[model samples]
Target: MNDLVERFEVAFNQIHQHLKEFNGYPKNDNFVELLQRSKLKHSVIRVHFDLLKQYAKLRNALVHERIRDDYYIATPHLEVVESLEHIKQTLDQPPEALEFATHPVIFFKDTSLLTEIMTAFDQQGVSQFPIYSKDNEFLGLLTNDGIVRWIARSVDNNVVNLAGVTAKDVLQDGLNPSIEFLSSHGTVYELEERFERSLEEERKLKAVILTESGKANDAPLGIVTTWDLIKVDRRNEDE
Candidate 1:
């Protein structure tokens, strides 16, 4: 029982220290209050906060109450201690989804020339480009398939002005591109869930764009694809 109590306190303190560092030292010293405040600001913390609170209460009971030593008043179950440890591990080293994401994403204006778009694709070896409006509002994704379809249609119509064609033209011609937006702090688990949702819905999600506020208008911090997730899993396995 003594060993269990010590282990539980150690795990709890580790998480508390991590939260302090993560939040830049909040005013509150209470663990539950700190977690509640963090959850209000971060979606990542909110997901596991309730479980953390429960464990915190258990810690309080074990530390404050003094029952018969022989009876082992507060025997911390192994699974319960392991759960707290898992939460600490998650908060300590969040899945490297955002870190592994492709950064400095190649985006284009809706009126950007087809030649410019093609050059970007050739140079970057990128198939998807997030297009924006004149006012810098996110329009949609422009994929290689959309470009090919546009070229095929233009050739059939004997349109010689390929240079004048723009991303807007392709969009006007009914290009359906799929995209998902998530905050830069999102975990790899959340990213995988989004991909799974896309698959279940049978929708082709071209990319998952990460931004400061997860808003489309904001400049993307990074981008993730299904391939990125696979590579992450493979790297973890190798490790």
Candidate 2:
């Protein structure tokens, strides 16, 4: 009784410290918001707080209720942290670097000449391009905006080469259509919200590519787009 209570306190203090360490942006939020909020912006701190509360609860149960001091009680909670760490790792990694889009990107030779634009549109893939060079080297990315801009500028200028456009020319960088995936198998209201937001926001795809489990060069197994995210999750909603 007393032992469990004391252990819970110590564990809670650790939890508090960990949660507070976030600097209160999504002050108490877990890596989920940590991934989304773009460096712990304070407005969403309550979300983090909610996650920490849950994390603390599980941690207490695992440390105090489940495991005896003699036996290291490593159950789902420890695994939860590890799982969250993995989620953080995957979230921390840029989506482009993942090589998991359902579509392959088309590329041109360089930045100067508008020889051509490669597209997966023929294949019916995501609008973003993960470009490569003729030499098979990684090159800058092209976005729908970049393509549109190039089309708009083609009349006035001839700088439609691959080098002419880069990920810098488009893409919000830290901002893209994404949602956090939990390894433990779960779904949440927030996931739906992110998808809805992605749908409502322009300059990006209606689908939030969920990169959960797959090997290198893996395409997205499941995607939640605006339609599926909102009301039309079936035949009408497969964005």
Candidate 3:
């Protein structure tokens, strides 16, 4: 009995069951078919689609080519088994978005003064701030890039009246800052997908504001920026 083969089989079975459940357990489709279908709807599956397909073929060979109950013609490498297990765990319990998001999100109202906004940027060390209206409706994201643009414009035109400028006014002057909303329960995978989609569409996303139900009207619960995703990638590499 090869331990690596045993572990691989267990992990593969778990993944198969999960994907089956994800697709409502369609009886006619096989494992690979189920995986192909799931890849369309699940980010985890989509990201690992090719590797998963290879694993499926390996699983089939391992099961069908066994000489006997206690004998085998092929054995899985330890790394292969580990990778399968890791994917299974990720599918079962992915990290929540809020886990890595900046909590107690520092936001500004559209009417907030430049002085107050700058103070926040200095004190909080945050580049992006969610701007809302007086009625608390989300208006736009205020980014340091936008502030720099506003300042550059002011300096270029020799109009340096910063005292009276408001956050909304700065936003209008700044290079349009892009943002999206995610629910409190959103996963890190979803956040990464959002950023990836934005890039594909040629619109860079500045930040993702987490809310109660992923709506603009809901108050922000946390914030996830590109820097946060970089940290997450680094952490994954270290692990």
Top-scoring candidate (lDDT): 3
Error of 3 at 56 (Å): 6.3
List, residue by residue over 181-229, the lDDT tens digit for candidate 3: 9998998767777887787799988889999899987999999987887
Off-target runs (Cα >4 Å) in candidate 2 are 17-48, 51-119, 135-137, 156-239
Per-residue lDDT tens digits of candidate 1, residues 133-200?
A: 98979888888889888788778457656768888888788886778999888876567667767876
Model with the higher TM-score, candidate 1 or 2? 1
Q: How much lDDT does each candidate structure score?
A: 0.77, 0.40, 0.83
Query: What tens-digit string does per-residue lDDT give for candidate 2 at 1-239?
Result: 44444444454454344334433445445534443443222212333445445665566566657556644354443444553444333323312312222323243333423323434443545454443344544344454555666556544465544555444333323333333332112232334444434445644444443334422122334444344432322211121
The C-alpha local distance difference test score for the whole of candidate 3 amounts to: 0.83
Q: Model 1, stretches more than 4 Å misplaced? A: 1-88, 91-93, 157-160
Worst 10 residues of 3 by lDDT: 230-239
Ranking by lDDT: 3, 1, 2
